[model samples]
Target: MHRSVLPLVRQTLGKHPAMMGVASAATGFMRQMSIKPFTPANRRREFQLKDRVESLHACRTQIFKEKGVGELPTIVVGGFVPDATEQVEFQRPLFREYGSVYYLNYPRHGFSLEMFFAQLADLIEYLNARRQRPVLFGVSFGCGLIAQFLKESANDPNLKIRGVALASPVLCTADLIRPEGEKAGGVRMLESNLKRILKSAAEGSEGVERQIERARRCFQALFETGAANRALTGRHLSIRKKIMHVIETTPADGGYQRVLALQQLDGPRDGEAVFTGPTLALLAEAEDNLLVPTSPTLSLLRDPERRRHLFPRLSFWKVTSPEPDDAVAHASLIFHHHCYNPLIRSWYHKLQAPQLFAVI
Candidate 1:
């Protein structure tokens, strides 16, 4: 949180951690229970994905097929803090029209970041073996992992990825977790406050609530839903609640270790400017909160001359809100697929076309 708002949260939620946890738990429970998760059921293709080197870092995957989308499936590595239950929502609009997508639920109990990345590499190879090269779509931290995966496989003559899409990319954990000095501003309260909330997840129940509430508070501040927040309270509550639910349930160590794991990957060496094959960076219009141009990921993606030299095929595009009033947010990458899907669909088609530079 910005140093300015910390005192307010202290005054309102109080000094005691339990009081803080209990306060948000009640409302979170009500809201959480109110919106039931979309069950995969018949649409789901469930299976356990084991790591190559026999590690306990395997993650479960569910492939949902939209009837008649064909056998070519896209691998979607979603960002942190989402209710693992709502796996189906990630498919809407994006795959609804015509596609198959598989979602990975990161090991919730305990796992290391290196292990998980290795596990993701295993999953990609596993899927690639069975079918055609799978397209990759990622949001937030998931995007960071995708970038790492590409860097890891950069030397391979035959990488099987069909295409890649990244939204609200969080390429560095060190920058996000640390407090921002006014002299070196860019870290938003939403991103900084996450360090503390995510840490709470490692503590268990009370920790979980602390994680949920602080995350909610961060979003409230991000969207400016409350008087305390200096930003605009966006008009999209339905979307806001869904984003909150993501924070409430994502895989932590006890579950929280995921944060530390990501920190482990400071991201592809700034010097290793090796850009993968066909890539698309989906950016948000507004910055300073969650994503800023100066941030590592955004900066890398935004530089045209640099990308032209290194990541020649990498293209950049911005997504607008689904609703006129609801602005595009950090979490909206998966949540607001309507705006994103068209661009992605277009990008994929362009990647396969004879001329990659075909206009959208």
Candidate 2:
């Protein structure tokens, strides 16, 4: 009973029956005001428009500055997945490689081709406020967008880029995914079942023991692009395994922008781009050719004899690990950063040399 009704209880004890009923009514009113209802409604739909907005707000450009750095900040555009929220082995090694690092973070749903270019351009302009020329590093699908951006801004005198590095280059999306027939996607190269296989291999289970065993076999074949005998191990091999799983398992809505980008062909235009300082292409040991195996654009870029016909100066390096045990897979930079960062560090330093040294 409410303390406020205690006096009423006393008063009603000696009162008439009619007065007692009135006191009972007062007590019920006080009780209603003091206590909560038995059942409450839950209105959250999780990823309702509001939740998407809130999650997106949590993502933004993350900056890591190497102390005492001033120019040519390296900006890395990640593909598909945003750098993991926590315990992500992918990002943060770039700043340690050279100067400041500008890593793009996509709001859960705000990532798109147009958004990438806009955000990248804005970041460059913002940092250029102090008159610095930034270098661009593109990873996976990000390579396609950067290539297109370079083509579009080829003639823009105001847009001055120092150099570019493409990791596991996806110069063309149609290369990764091809339209097979009308009824459903073939059966294209990157099959959906691959995700299940990777997941099976990464997180083993007795329920799917047979499938897990099968995937472990195919998983080794995944490294066939580099060396069939290479059994990967070390620091972030397991982390890379998780990243590979996310790439294939990401929900449709989560990877909508990238999936949409897969349809159009962003082929490199023969003699078009202007900012050709020091373009470096780093292909993962296991992804040297499997990705975009028949991509004419990538083939042209990788062909040393023909690439210079387009890019006046270029450097191509296949990322390899000195220690045989390091798992230098497609997302090799994050998983085995030690293998790639020093190369990037050296490349960043070379960008300061005179034009004569720009060519390999």
Candidate 3:
């Protein structure tokens, strides 16, 4: 019976043109895989990029393998991105010591558990077949995937994972998803507007259609402004907001709420539950768009009891500077330009070195 749902789901997903774009915009969801044109300069650039990282297209996954020492500590880094494009060139040098660096891409315009788990299963199988144990490091939603892996492989002894690390983990409670009263910033305002729009669509839109369009336009403006200001990256945050608000407003009538259901699950609290191996977490300072201060998901990790109990081995480096005016610091919320600054890169390598990657 479950096998019968796949085709209908795909059909429904493809039915709406806007849904396709929404999906793509959500995950940098470009589906076409085009080879760059063969110009000498382009070839040279590709070669240079290839030298830094090897790209592999295999069975619903695009893996970017970085140059590693070949015989050092084995490790693999993966995430929810359709393509780990932004992280491709970042901190390449650090990966050199690892036996390999693999960034697994999500399925086109999607981050589905079945697809993600299958790909991960393949990776783990490939690694298990090898002579060494692989160190797995996941960031953000990647951390959630790691949790799944841990749950699935708890009894399997051959899969040697050195540790797990999550940067600004997503953990949340129920009530926070839908809050009453005034929204604080552009992000919340946009979310509020989008929620209203989706509700109008789900219910029969009579005169409500015009109001919905107006709200949609307002939300679009917020997205554009955020993107222009560099607060949001293209359309990622806006799509995220859309999805969050949709689920939040969805009727509690049981079937499977999926995303929101996951949001309600309990995760190992910060410093509360020590993982099987070494653990590291880069607690972002409030300003990082990757982890907003008000996110209910992050509150799970902030609890003192949870921190003390679960993350005893967890090493945390504030992803921000202690002072707001320190423009050079990585976590300065007001001035996020620091995220890409070279000094911040150094901080990442430094923190990553002592915690996740042992000196080889």
- Quick one: best lDDT, which candidate? 1
lDDT of 2 by residue, 1-360 (tens): 697986565555435655544544564454334322211022122223333343434323333333224455666676655342212233444443445555554444334444445556666666666666677877876677778878766766656677888777776654554333322423423533233433443454442444433434443455334434433332233344444554444333334434445435366666655346678777667663345445555577667776786567777777887877654777555446777877766776677655435444
Using lDDT as the yardstick, the better of models 1 and 3 is 1
RMSD of 3: 15.3
Q: Score residue 103 of candidate 2 by CA lDDT.
A: 55
lDDT of 3 at 133: 49
lDDT against true structure, model 2: 0.54
Tell me the tens digit of each residue's lDDT in model 3 across 1-360. 396885565456557757755654654433122111111111222233333322212113344444456433323343322133333333334545455555654433223344345455555556656654455555455566666557655776656665565554543322123454534443444344434544554565452454444544553453344345332332344344543343333232211222323443354544434365666665556423333336544565556556545555555555654456432221121233345334334533444465445545
TM-scores of the candidates are: 0.65, 0.60, 0.52
**Cα distance off (Å), candidate 2, residue 23:** 64
Better of 1 and 2 by TM-score: 1
Q: Pick the candidate with the highest TM-score.
A: 1
Q: Tell me the whole-model lDDT of each prediction, alpha carbons only.
A: 0.56, 0.54, 0.44
The local lDDT score (0 to 100) that residue 278 gets in candidate 1 is: 73
User: Tens digit of lDDT per residue, candidate 1, span 110-148?
Assistant: 545555554456555665666556667777777777777
